[model samples]
Target: MTSSPVPDTPVEVIVDLLTKAQDIASYCDNMISDLFLAGQTLKMLIHMSQAKRVLEIGMFTGYGALSMAEALPEDGCLVACELEPYLKEFAQPIFDKSPHGKKINVKTGNAMETLKELATAGEQFDMVFIDADKNNYINYYKFIMDNNMLRLRGVICIDNSLFKARVYLNETTDSNGLALREFNQFVSNDPRVEQVIPLRDGLTLIRRVPPCKITDDEVFRGVTGRFILDRMRLDGKVAYVTGAGQGIGRAFAHALGEAGAKVAVVDLDGAKAETVVEELFLKGINAISITADISKSDDVQRMIDAIVSKWGVIHIGCNNAGINMNSASEDTSLEEWDKTFNVNLRGTFMCCQAAGRVMLKQGYGKIINTASMASLIVPHPQKQLSYNTSKAGVVKLTQTLGTEWADRGVRVNCISPGIVDTPLIHSESLRPLVQRWLSDIPAGRLAQVTDLQAAVVYLASDASDYMTGHNLVIEGGQSLW
Candidate 1:
């Protein structure tokens, strides 16, 4: 078991308030953030992240607010969200007594309203601490991500994540426990990366998966002229994603379908592929699902034939399905190496070759492959010698085909992403290593699957007709260091 934490700064304010509030008939300690739990961690996290602005969803007793304020830089700001106005009065004298009190601003009333107001004003935060009503935990997290209120390198800490251990236990009628359980599961499936520290009530730290500034606002600025815009539209194109069942591949399937292409969602799992087809149908996009293993040449050929027969032509091919297995160089077995290579390199080759034949006959096609940052740079701290080497081979394969096919009206390209926050790293074994990886990244975040949507669209559309034999890397500059 971990030892209880001691604050780096003296919390004389907490001592004073507890001593005085004991006699107040309206006082309650249940909502207070104790130093033994989330209190001290918030201070250390702020200091480590060098956060300039912090948000506390519930500021009872001003202990959490004061502790975090003490950790902020001299110019830093801390916005406290509180529902009860009387607590501010009780905590005001204690706040006035501390030197860091000037940095704290307490906003009283409904927190949901405060959040909406902040959204309207275009506010963002480096750190957000939530210790509010349990029922609203999931709602708060969703709002923060949807509104872009969290900075690229920012983190959100949720207190009482374990909810007295009911979150992991059998079903409970306790509304608080049930809500926390739902919140934990929801975050697990989210695009962001998170880690839960078993600090008494459990503190979960979450951060965005990707870093990029090219949003709709930039597109809305009319950077693309109407004259050349037609080249970017995929109105009559036919596309297919090899791993269209879920995660990044699923996202690419949706993106290409939405871009006006008839998509064939291909995956090893027939049910998953069919589900994606249903999603496309809901969006009024003509689509189909093909179950095939890219490693098998027959399967790959059949998958391609089905698409060509349905659409009468294949204009775009997204070879996005791949796998990774980590093992020490000396310990990597031949079976492990072959499995990694079979999918990452050989499987991609078969898909490219089969799709190239159809495109070569038609005299036109765009092939987008999925590569990894590991292909270019060794992402250390986790040993995956085979996985890294296989991806490097994929880059070479893409360049080989791209140059050969360029003169034949077939453009081949690959997209290399930084360590994406996918289900691959959600295992308990990889959690600690993910934390180390985050610290080394300059952008301080992983790439969300959504971050790569537009990249695939560009490579598939005529906008990149002249660009071939290129590796479009969307990694958040993690390989630079």
Candidate 2:
């Protein structure tokens, strides 16, 4: 059995320290060390008694620094490097209030250069916390070790070593994922480090071994627009999308067309419909474009007809269009209220009704609706009464239709996106509110378009055949609040 935690420190002391650490880390000005975990403080402290001098490389709000500083003896000292002056200024008071404040020194500037300077000054540490720079994690570790910043028995803690657990998978493509994968392998084989912790994102705890170095062998390296189209076949299949003239809609149309489904690109602008169709024809996706207000029936009907006349069937329908007014109930206008629902809600229902009929006959089809986390929770700093209400309606609609069409083979589902970095979001209405709502997002930023692709692919593929009427909330746990 594994040995128990040290009995010298009271559990309550650890809990209080961690609580303060979390509060300080959560400060808005410091996004650098935003990935630090409070729980890791307890483990880090257990290994900290051996060190009289501790250095924390990334001191975002001073959470990691504070936690490690508190564990140091009266003669022990901590040097924390924070690049942002505002963050340093903001966090200084928090540290000043701490009992170990006198023992901690806050340094400001580029962490790589600062750490190098400290090494040049013969500054060594018994413990170090490396929690910055995803793209430079491997390089940073090498620099810290090459300069002998850590004594042979010194302990080093690296946070975000997992990069959202993406590195463990095979399909990782982003820089963060690639860098983490490389770092993990480097640490795993580096004779200098004994163990690594695969915590939340990831954390590695390594004890310095003299004459050992992190080698290069471990060094690893790692848009839309809308438009028109025409359906080629429907024999018994149907497909539809909102905002189809540009961005993700155009991408989805090409994908579905290549698969042989008669696809419809639904857009508010008629000209966009024609343009999208032309692009699809060039790619051979059997696609067409229809200009219709998603919220209005007559408009949707014209587009629906284009698909029916060409393919004689409807199978896949996508509710992918939405708008944001960015107004609270008091500030929101009746026009904004009606307009948002008209497109996201009324339009979704109109398309569902038209496609539901065809699917009821065929007894097999798929309907994918796009919902938003604004529907599930009240997002802060950025308020959009109309947008939130409309998306909420889409969720209930999906569930209701899913129940009605389950036996009919028509799977109805919704993809609830968090704040996606889309053109619409970048529109005049949303840009002002981005920075306000960003801090609330668990993922630390707006959702990327690529982030939504997999969720859509999953819902559209046969892999989700057995799944129906499910509201797939993909907002990066924003609703967890």
Candidate 3:
């Protein structure tokens, strides 16, 4: 059986310890076989399953046990069993030296007896690794099934089922080989679990199937329709909203908070962010505030880091921090143009990139960028050339990332809002300009901050699971005029 190499530092250390133990076991002729699993393989299995409680039938020298334990979370536990008392004694010292040693509980006794005791205690495990006596493989399988020791949909991994390639030999008299051959067939015929993977050394992975409750009639009715409102609910989800201090971004923070998300209000103005977060708390929503300049990469990274350090994962990101500048196309200074792009385009890119990393690793995320209706059509009376161009670039940036990350489980979309009744549009210098643009809007009124809230919630929820790479236009027929 070929072994996969482990390159990680922790796995490498375990491999070293296993090699030393293998030499000792061979020199002593203790009949303690060095049929230990590859460190990388065991770690991968534990991590992929997110196994909190693991049961290892054969502890051996603790290499596999240590590897699995190290992959678990701080509160996770591993119960290990070994037939030889000396093997536990030999491995305990090594485990003691590792920080993850506390997670491993080594039990020395007859594995069958230990299994029976665990079953009687009603203990369940997320995963069970069997690498003990080959002859009793089938018996261990039956015990786990009969006692309900494994949780539903849990994993059962059997190692060394090939018996050194002797299982394929029909005339082999080896008792272990014959037993393994019989065990493989027994598991194959069992309908409760589906034999999933066959890896090195005849390693077999069996996943217990949960009972199917949905019927053909349910399928015809479209099961998703029943939970339409529930699907939109973001209970227990964590959301980060940039520029949440005031204006449209503040409205988004409130909307997400009301929809059951724990909101992180991020703004360059630390006081403003905290004020908004305090208001959210008074409204019975969980919230926090973070100060960061999105244009600076270090600040943006720190913002994401702080949120993840506190919440463990980021489910939604709203890249809304931006600046606006109104200047004639010919009279716009370089500094004015650069500052607009820095916050509007560069800042948005940095936030998306940072949040994208977290989302890609989690395999599920939603990112909504704030584009402007000026992206579709330049404002008639406004002379903000830089603002219009920067927003247009945002639309294309969203489309590019949306297409690239859709398959990776993260959806990127942008919202282009029309003239909104915010401080940004009601400034003393823009009052005349604002009134002139209102005549062009068929709705006859500037958009309210609340008008954009529903659209943001819809894009953030699972109700938009099938949508991506599309700019959701919230303008009230102004672009048409």
- Model-by-model lDDT, in order? 0.86, 0.73, 0.88
lDDT of 1: 0.86
Could you give the C-alpha RMSD of every candidate to the true structure, in order shown? 17.8, 21.2, 16.8
Highest TM-score among the candidates is held by which one?
3
Candidate 3 residue pairs in backbone clash: none
lDDT of 3 by residue, 1-481 (tens): 2244643544355565555565656563232233334655888999999899999999987888988998999999999999999998888877787888889999999899999989888999999999999999999999998788888768999998887889999999999999999999999988778886467767889898754455545343334633455577888999999999999999999999998999999999999999999999999999999999999999999999999999999999999988988889999999999999999999999999999999999999999999999899988777899999999999999999999999999999999999989998778788888778878999998999899998888889988988987899888889988
List, residue by residue over 1-481, the lDDT tens digit for candidate 2: 2233543333233344444555666552233233234535633564444578988777776655666666678888988888888878866776676777677898899888888889889999887778777887888788877787778667877877877778877987888889889988887888766765676557677886544333423221100111111122232345777787876666666656665566788888879978988887887666777777877788777777777787777778887877667776898988999988888898888888887887788887788888878778978776778888898999999999998888978899998888777677677766788887776777778877667665665566555678888988877777885
Task: List TM-scores for all candidates, in order.
Answer: 0.54, 0.49, 0.55
Using lDDT as the measure, the top candidate is: 3
Ranking of predictions according to lDDT? 3, 1, 2
What is the per-residue lDDT of model 1 for residues 1-481, given as tens digits with 9 covering 90 to 100? Answer: 2233443333664754453554463343543435434567789999888899998999987888888898999999898899999998977777777788888988999888999999999999999998999999999989988999898668888988999898887858889999999998898888665555646677888876553335555343333532244557688899999989998999999999888999999999999999999999999888999999988889999999898888899999999889888889999999999988888899999999999999999899999999989999998788999989999998999999999999999999999999889888887778888888988788889889999999999999988889898998888888888
Better of 1 and 3 by TM-score: 3
Q: Single out the weakest 10-residue window by summed lDDT for candidate 2.
A: 220-229
